[model samples]
Target: MINTFKKDDAQALKGIAIIMMIFHHCFSSTELYEKYTISFFPFKENIIVNIAVICKICVALFAFISGYGLIISYEKKKATASRWALSRYIKTFSGFWIIYILLAFVNIIFRSRFLKVYFGHGIWIGIASVFLDFAGFAKLFGTDTLLVTWWYMSAAVVYILLVPLLYKELKDKTWIILIFSMFFLRVILSHTDAGSFTGSNSIYAFIPVFISGSIFATTLFFSGGY
Candidate 1:
């Protein structure tokens, strides 16, 4: 029997992940309840908070989908790694830069305190950080920027660039790659400070979840079934 994730299957998974993300952002923190009342199940705040916390798996879901989709695309396209990576980056950056630039321009026009407060030190330092933010390297460089969620930007770029190389090297050995990714993630989490959400945004931290997706793609496409 053939088992595979069809296009709609992937899209449905993504929709579920998005809904989970919304729940996580809405109720994961008890502080949110302090600011806004919960009309539904108002007395079950603890249950809601716990459920929301578990919903954090949305990040892993997204990474897995990205890996699966990219690998499937690569398998179909047979494009060179550099070309594929460049195309993916261009697609990602096009949308990213539009929002990044719009926000920056708005902040500048309004003299919003975000830039001054986050991008610190002298004027030149602040300017350099802004450029880094444009490239999604500000968080990696430890230079604070406006958006905490933008850490995913750098993480996404890293995944796109790495996926082609990973597919090339491990296409035939998907299980090995999956095992290695898990081992690497454990080592990083156990040995370093990259366990927290902020610290976990490092480029290599979420490779396990991504590679799990790749493994699924390999099973479905390259190996021709499970």
Candidate 2:
């Protein structure tokens, strides 16, 4: 397919989506940065749920944008892509653990879950699970969740794992199937779970979102002239 969507518009929409995610996570508003941003939308409990729905779209959309950016980056240089992939995996693993460590230290020092408010449990076990996502321990061990955003990083790891395959064989049809399957699965899971599939929502349900990101990344490759 031709690059029909306006590049500028897509970029703008991506910007909007990111900002929305930030707001949804931070203040749980699409843009609680300003008082008037959600002035039109009702500000009730249910309304907040509605706002979060829109924010989830922003996250899914951001995953797509991430895929778009990464695929294009890989296409530009093979050696660079390989290095980038390794570096990304290392970065994600290290980054998650580093944050987990800091958060655990802070929690031990403060003896408060307030830091836990944003992140989550951060003992040694949480530290390991948060970074490695080695769920093998999550059942026996506990979760850290110091930064709720760790979920995003966890999802990123999954998307990264698909890069080699996407760059090689699945760049075309496999990606399309992933995109469709994920979208459909998301709907099914959402209805069954009564919405919300972030952490432990479905025995680690980042697969759909991760693949969706790949689909978005594929389009970016096309639009980027890669």
Candidate 3:
């Protein structure tokens, strides 16, 4: 018998993750988040805070889904790693590069007057910064300057590149290692200055989650359970 995977549930999860992300962002700016002091009769302020915290899990969910989906695709297509990575790179960065180019032109034409305010740099610097970010060197050195969210894309790219090397060796025990390593890293980082900058926005911070998802995909496929 041939085993085929149905993606309806994955699609539903993606939709839910997107909604949660939007809610998380919206609530982040509200007084409930600011004060962390809002409460009802039976619930405490920590409930509200916890809800906001849970909502932020959408970022991890997205990364997990990306890793899961890519593994599934790779299995189904039986594509070479280089070809797969190249295709993924183009698909991911083509649109991003277009937008980046447009933004660069706008910044240059405006003499870097607008983006400079937020990025604290001129057009030339902005272009260079994005290149550094895309290469994943900026985040490694704690010098990222593109945007807070761009970390996701950078991390995803790094994960994709590393997948070819790590998947076969680590796929079976991903969950165990991911959980332990991430927890240990969290504990270590919590007491360090670099922790403040890493947050949930760096490749190192999300690699475990991504690998977990990839392992899940591999398991589901090999077990014919998906």
Worst 10 residues of 2 by lDDT: 133-142
lDDT of 1 at 58: 81
Model 3 alpha-carbon drift over 4 Å, by segment: 1-5, 29-50, 77-79, 98-126, 133-146, 170-199, 220-226
Q: How much lDDT does candidate 3 score?
A: 0.64
CA deviation > 4 Å runs, candidate 1: 1-3, 117-119, 196-202, 221-226
Clashes of 3: 0
The count of residue-pair clashes in candidate 2 stands at 9
Supply the TM-score for candidate 2. Answer: 0.58
Give candidate 2 regions above 4 Å deviation.
1-14, 26-49, 80-83, 91-105, 112-142, 171-213, 216-222
TM-score for candidate 1: 0.85
Model 1: pairs clashing at backbone N, Cα or C within 3 Å: none
Candidate 1 local lDDT, residue 44: 71
> CA shift at 81, candidate 1, in angstroms?
1.5
**lDDT for model 2:** 0.57
State the lDDT at 174 in candidate 2: 65
